[model samples]
Target: MANASSMKIRVEELESGMITAENVIEPGTERILLLRDTILDSVMIFNLKERYNVDEVYIRKNFSAATVADEMRAEIDIHQSLSTLKEVFGSDEDKPLTEFSKEATKQISNVTNELITSLYADDNILLKMHQLQSYDDYTYKHCLRVAMMSVTIGKSLDLPRNKMRDLCEAALLHDIGKRTIDVDIIRKPGRLTDEEFEAIKKHPQNGYLLLRKNGSYSEEILNGVLMHHEKYDGTGYPLKLRGEQITYLARIITVADVYDALTSNRPYRQPWSVAEAEEFMMGGANTHFDYDIIMAFLAAFAPYPVGDRVLLSDGNKAEVISNNTNVLRPVIKILTGENADEVIDLYNDFKYLTLSIKCLDKDGSTGE
Candidate 1:
C-alpha cells in the first residue's frame, strides 16, 4: 500500500471533512470501528468522543477528503513486544526455571493483550512481522512473532475475545519446555543423536507440566502448549493425536510456529525467501497442518502487497500492481531497465517463469 502523508492528531481535535489514514480499532480487542479513508462528520466525531476510548487518529496531511484515495498503511509496533519478550525469555544463568515460568506467565499476559489490539488494526501485520528478521536472541523474538501470527490467524477465523487472549498467551509460551532441557542438547551445533533428539522432543510436555504446576494458566492455554507440536496426520511427537483430537488453538499455533521458524534468521542456516516459505506452508496442508488453519495463514500473510517497490531476483526493481491467484507471484510493473513501466503477470506469463521477488525495500520513504 502507498503510505500517504499523514499527521497524528488527538480525537478531540478531529474535525468534519477530515479523512482517516488508518483503521480505528476497539481498545484491547479485535473489533474495528472505522476504516481508512472514512471521512469524518459531526455525528461520527460525536460518537467517537462519547463511546470510543480512542485517543488519537492519523489523518491525511495535505489533501482534501473529497479527492484523496486511501493509499495509507498502518503497522503494528513489534519492537516493544520484542523488548518485553526479551525481558521474560532472555537468558539469565541466575534465573530459576520456576521463577522464569512465573515471570513469563505474568509478562506474556500483558504483551499479548496489546498485540491483539494492534494486530487487528493493521491488516498488513503479518507482512510487518516478516520484515522483523534479525539474528540476535532468536528464541525471544521467535516466540513473539509466533504469538503475533497466531492472533492473526485467530482473527481470520473470528475467534471469540477470551479465546483470542488464550491463543496469544499459549503461542508466546509454546516452547517454554526448552528451558528445562540441558543447554548442550538444546544448542548443539551438529545433528543430535537419537537419544538427544528424544530429549529435545520433550519440550512441549515439559512446557505443559511447568505451566500447569504454576496453576495460573487455563486448560486451553495448557493444552495449546502441549499439543502445538501435534500433526494432523498423526506423525508428531509427545503424542500422536490426529485430526480434531488436537486442540483448535494448538493447530493454529502449529501453522504459525512452523512458518516463523522457516523464515527466521537462525544462526545455523539462512532464512528461506518469503515465496519459498509460503509454498512450503501450502504443501503442508492436511499432513503437517490443518487445512482450515493453512487457509487462514494464507489469508493473513501477504509478503507483497500493492504499491510495494520490490527487488526481483533478476536485478530489477518493480512496483507491485496487484496479486494474482498466487499472492507471492504478483503482477508487477518494472520500474527500471529497458522494460521500464512494463507490467508482467508473474503467475500466468510463461516467459517470466524464472523471475521472482527477492525482498521488499522497507526504507519507509513515501511516494514511489
Candidate 2:
C-alpha cells in the first residue's frame, strides 16, 4: 500500500502503472483479488473483475489535498487583484494619466506582488489554481491571464526576483490601453475594416504614452507596454523593432499575449483547444515570436491542462489525470469505450497503440 494518504477508486477506473494503495478483495467471497502495492495493468483489471468479482481498488493520490486548499486561497488572491485593476482602468477611457499619485496604481503593484509570492510558494499549485472566467469583462480577465502566464515563463527562465516582478507588472498592465478604445470595435462580432484594424493597432502606443505620462514606472516597464506588439521579424506595428531591438520584457510578454488571445473566446470565434494553441505558437517561432521565449513557455505550461476531456486517436475519450515530462502525452482516466475509467500513460504505451489528442471537449474544461 502507498500509505494512508491514498484514495479508493472503482476497479474499472484503475489506471495501468498505478501502485495499489490497498488490497482488493472479491465481493462476498473474502478472496483477495489483488495484493497491496501491486502495479495495475489492463490484464490485472480484467482478471480482478471478471474472474475474482472485485469491484473497487485503491491508488495513491497523485497530488495532495493541500493543493486544493492552496487553489482556494489563490482564487481569493486573484479576485482581489482583479478588483484593484478594475478600479484603476475600468472608467479611465480617453482620460490619459497626468499624474501618478493615484492609490489605485500602488494597489495594482501590491496585487502583483502577492500574485508573484503565491506562484513561487508552490510549483505544483501554479496552473492548478487557475479559475475559469465568464466572457463578460473580457479585458480584465485577459490581462490577468497574461500576467500570470508571463510570470510563469519568468519563473521557468529562473529570472531574478526583481526582473520577475517587473515582468508581471508589465504583463498585467500591457493591455491597459484597450480600455480607452471604443468598445464597439473591441468587441466587434465580425471582421474589421482596414481602418478599424488600424485603430486597434494603436493600443500599444496609447498604453505606453499613458503609462509614461504617469511618471511612476521604470523605462523597462514602459517599453514592455509599448513594444509588446513588436514581432521578432520586424513586421509588428508602431515601432517595427526587430530581433534584439525589441525590449526583452516586451518579447516575453508578446508570447504570453498571443497565447492568451488565441486560447480565449472572442466575440468572433470560439477558443482554440490547448493542443491547437500550442501548435500555433510553436509554428510562430522566430517569425512572429522569439524562439527562446516560446520554448520557455512550452516548459512552463503543459499543453493539456488537468481535467480536460480529450478524444484519443484510438477513438476513446479520457479525462487528463496527470502530466508527464512529455507535455503532449499525459496520463488519462478513460471515461468511455471498453476501457471506461481505466487510466493509461500515452507516452509509455506507445508500442501497444498509437495515441494522439483528437480534440478537447468544449464544455468541460477551460483550454487555457
Q: Report the CA-based lDDT of candidate 2 relative to the real structure.
A: 0.73
Please give, for residues 1-368, the per-residue lDDT of candidate 1 as tens digits: 34445667889999876766655666776555554456666666787778877887766678654332221222224566777887776574534355355676678888887788776666445544643555667787788889888999999899998999999999999998887787778778898999999998999999899889988999999999999999999999789999999999999999999998987766666667566798899899999899988887886676676766788888888888988757788999998788989999999998999999877753321232
Index of the highest-TM-score prediction: 2
Q: Which stretches of candidate 1 lie over 4 Å from their true place?
A: 1-80, 90-103, 123-132, 308-319, 332-368
Candidate 1 positional error at 77, Å: 6.4
Q: Local distance difference test, per candidate?
A: 0.77, 0.73
lDDT of 2 by residue, 1-43 (tens): 1223366677788755565655465678544455444545567
Off-target runs (Cα >4 Å) in candidate 2 are 1-69, 92-101, 123-129, 182-191, 305-310, 314-326, 329-355, 360-368
Span of ten consecutive residues with least summed lDDT in model 1: 67-76
For residue 106, model 2's alpha carbon misses the true position, in angstroms, by 0.7
Q: What total of clashing residue pairs does each candidate reach?
A: 0, 1
